[model samples]
Target: MIRHLVLFKLGEGVERDDPRVLEGVDAFRSLDGKIPEIRFWELGWNFSDRPIAYDFAINSGFDDADALRRYLEHPEHQAGVTLWKEFSTWVIADYEY
Candidate 1:
């Protein structure tokens, strides 16, 4: 199995309550049921006040690297990424367990 992790930091001056951000969040949350390559998906806003913490996170699992790649290339996932690109930057990691 593979674990794919992502941490997002909102762009400067961007707020969580912004309409675009909300839509982006919904888009990601919706991916669970829409993408077959995604065996597991969990996303949420960060509640931490720590300076080093990211604003959002996505923790997902897949069968393998190819499954992970498919999920990344899926249209629904790409659309969510496009929305997030307008207001945030993120880092990701993937590893097998």
Candidate 2:
């Protein structure tokens, strides 16, 4: 199994309290059952003061590299990525274990 983790920083002028932020959160949370290759999905919004912490984080599980590749190329995921790009400034990742 492989765990795909991503952390996102919102773009300039994008507030944490913005409604679009919640919409993005919901969109990611909804992908678990909809994407067959996604074994599990979890999302989080940071409310702490950590200097390096991102605004949001997503943790997804896949059965193998092929499953992960499929999830990455899925049409629904592409749409989600498009939506995310609008408000996201930076993205970081960890794709092992």
RMSD of each: 0.6, 1.6
Instruction: Evaluate residue 38 in candidate 2 and report its C-alpha lDDT on the 0 to 100 scale.
Output: 88
RMSD of 2: 1.6
> Per-residue lDDT of 1-97 in model 2, one digit per residue for the tens?
8888888999889987788877777777788789999887888887878888788888888988889999989988877787788889656453667
- Model 1 pairs in collision: none
- State residue 83's C-alpha deviation in candidate 2, in Å: 0.7
In the range 17-36, model 1's lDDT, one tens digit per residue, is 99999999999999997999
Count of clashing residue pairs in every prediction = 0, 0
lDDT value, candidate 2, whole model? 0.82
Model 1: residues with Cα > 4 Å off, grouped in runs: none
Q: How many backbone clashes does candidate 2 have?
A: 0
Off by over 4 Å in 2: none
Please state the error at residue 68 of candidate 2 in Å.
Answer: 0.5
